[model samples]
Target chain A: MRLKTRPSHREKQLSEDKNFLHRFGYAQELLRDMGGFSNFAISFSIISILTGAVSLYGHGLTYGGTGMMGFGWPLVALFCMMVAASMAELASAIPTAGALYHWASLLGNKRWGWYTAWINLIGQIGIVAGIDYSVAFFADGLLSPVLGYRMTETTTLIIFALVLVSHGVLNHVGIRIVARLNDFSAWYHLGVVLILVVSLAGFGKGELQPVDSLFRLGETFSDKPYWLAFLIGLLQAQWTFTGYDASAHTIEETIHPRVRAPWGIFSSVAFSFVAGMIMLAFVTLSIQDVHAAVSADNPFIFVISQALGSTFGQVVLWMIVLAMWFCGLSSVTSFSRMMYAFARDRGMPRSDWFARINKHYRTPVAAIWLAVILSFILALTDYFIKLVNPDTTYTTLAFLTGVSVVGLYVSYGIPIWLRLIAESKGRFTPRHLGPWNLGKWGRTVAILALLWIAIISVVMVIPPNQNAGIALIMMMIVLLIMDLTYYRHHFPGPEAALQVSPEELARREAEFHD
Target chain B: MTMLGVLLILAACAVALAIGIIANRNVRAFNEETHESFLGDRKERDAFEDPSVS
Candidate 1:
């Protein structure tokens, strides 16, 4: 055998580049290239409908609305959602896995980027766990009767396992396939919900109640404050519309990302708002007794079953359950990609493992599975807790998810402010969005959205009861404990990823040209 | 019997899994070929970077 030669300096550089490309898969030139406006609209619409529909029926319209009575339930839905829409637009334009956190780092002083990404990452995983566990709840409801089994913790685990595996396999299939499937899921969800809601409304036997009486914000049966209910409703709306930033996570994979990604993000939010409003209206109209029905287990299912008998109703319920699984799976897929992107940058523990792509699937299989396993474990916590107290087992995992949503918005707001600050100092210039510039409107909208999200975050953590207060506190503790273990070691990084100095990059380009 | 239903479910899952395994293997082969063809020192650039190759 011949002796190996030492690598030349250029060879060493080439080798490092090759290794990086191999690790991350081929450079998806998505940052500079993305599909047309239509593709953005379609993809965003798909993801939004998938994420939105499950929450609308399961929680948003009825229970969530009931909680936000003080803010004029319907009007609150309208105003808060408009802010969310503007925020989504901002997130879309700067789509990256670091997402809002990365944007914050890029726009702000370099010192803040690492901590911001950490917060966003923590929030994202919490949302993944929440969405996945909800699938368990919905699946358990559908399968219990079909399998001739009761709603035990074991059955819930099985439900979570099947979904986790299906999602893992599907995510392994790659982004193009996932986007196509999401397209089907979006239209399928709309079709199913439209058919079910219309059919139930037309054939339903329940006498219609007056909207004015039903929405009377101050009408209270107990000592609970009316404002408390409204605050809860706002939280629900936020949850229902929360994950539309999914488009931002896929920006690296999209073609012509800056423009298209923003469109996707905004369209998903706008479409979901419309579709969700309709679904909420239909469910509100379909209820037999609004007050009593909202409190029932699977209230939407109850409304369907009451209107269409057990046989036909169960079919519709099962369809919704399946759609919910698709939603959860899609959400998890986005969540894993975000984690993979961050970990690839050595921003997370097990960066090598987390960042690894499946050569076969052209997907982040390792990250996808990691997300699933974590979610599965979280789902088990519900079963264990509920075993001790039957009533408590069905606690709001989504509320914890709401905390993450607030975290996401804060991540978003931080970046927007930093970008503005950088612009003021002449260190950053606003990127062109072609002729569709928000112009002066961008500044006004951005400020309003940031303030609104901050307020919502505080409202979300307010305990529903003394017990809920304690629960919220403990949840924060758990999140903090987890963060310390994984992220605290590398509390920050060497500070290059955060450097978005326009002048420096410009100078480098000039030198290279010379 | 519903046991029949269970068996049918298992059979469907088997069929799906088989297809997935075959598909996964084929994709792996394709990626390996692509990596060799595009990034391989022997191969010249074909036009430019693929739009989908992020």
Candidate 2:
């Protein structure tokens, strides 16, 4: 007879983790190997400070000038940490995949989950679309001499498809590979940023901007009020601060999730908040001529080339492109995970198709493609729009950013709001509170977070992004219609998973093992 | 001054987060205790409802 042996501490911990998840009515499907750092890395990689900061640097300069660049960023960062802290508490209480959806379903209602899941997914898809398209745009502009042609709409679509396809394939393989890359990406962002900041200070031959100009209290462009433009400039940092929820959304695959995942959420934002400020400050200070840099077609590139030679700048740009690629890769991973979790509860239109996990790969093959294809379609919106209305300034680029930033903030707000309401009513008892809780500070943070979301959502949709504003209103009407006609009858919501008995739950999990 | 204010707020948040980490380190044990309490209460209720307990 084989001797009975005690389970190792790691094995015991895994069992406890699985049981904790089972209470929330989920099977341990995704491999649970991600530690605190790995959990933090996924969110950090998705945040991709280099990608957002560099991509939107010109927008900041044109709209808000030095004051906005200096003041607006950290202000946005401060509010974003409040948002992260609020989210972290919820992430701790119920550390599930597609965390926002689960939190809403339990705290509020199924309809809330449905809307939150859809909006969050839309935001993520928009992010993936925007990130990859920026890569193609930069590659065409910066490397055109070597590549031999500028990117037309047709060529741009081709490049966009290629980039999305690569991310899809990488994600389809498995989370292990994706997590490893995300870990490397986190370090890469910090290291490259350190290099870039130092390079700008040490290698620049150009005259620096005035020291006092950093706090100059006015806008460079006055087409709009200084305050309005400054708020609009907040998009540059607001966009970067997003996707830190990737940590929450991947908690099922993380160990000791209640504590680790919350840490992941806050740490990712806090790090990006600091690192991004340093990077932008260096770039702003290195500007030889404000007019020349701001008026140039691509201010970020112009600033780099002016500070260092074009050859050296090109090297830096290539590194940034690679960072964007990693950003897209990590994004698709989070997108598919959320899609899979939502579909698992029959929340999506074709739930079963998207919810399937490849037995061998243990990854959602169909959902990965769903994210790729949806984002690709959104990416092409600009191409068709420009072809139809050549004079229009309303491109889908702003639409994508608006949807991504505003839609995500809205999705994030629903759960926070619901939790606040539950607490105010005294319905949310201590058992409902998570281990890594904000306690008395929770309500205060949630209120601030919602107020910030409301402010930014309005700012994101006005003026140049009016089309996005219209689109969002249309989306709400469509969702309400769908809920009444289709989902009301057909969809079971999260109860499909949540109502399962203990015996049934074990049987379903066993099927995976076999 | 704005920079200083922002940095100050960020630092306060960071310190609070660090405190949360140390405070919540024993979630696994807390979860176990909660589960045991729940099961123990259920068993007591079951025993109380037994017909022979009269």
All candidates: DockQ: 0.01, 0.07
For candidate 2, what is the DockQ?
0.07
Query: Of the true contacts between chains A and B, what fraction does model 2 have?
Result: 0.04
Candidate 2 residue A236 Cα shift, in angstroms, is: 0.7
> Mind giving the per-residue lDDT tens digits that candidate 1 earns over A14-107?
3433333232133332222224343343334333443434443444434334323222223433444445445444453344555555555445
Q: Chain B alone, TM-score of each model?
A: 0.51, 0.46
Superposition error at A168 for model 2 (Å):
0.2
TM-scores of all models?
0.73, 0.91
Worst 10 residues of 2 chain A by lDDT: A1-10
Native interface contact recovery, model 1: 0.00
The TM-scores, chain A only, for the candidates as listed are 0.79, 0.96
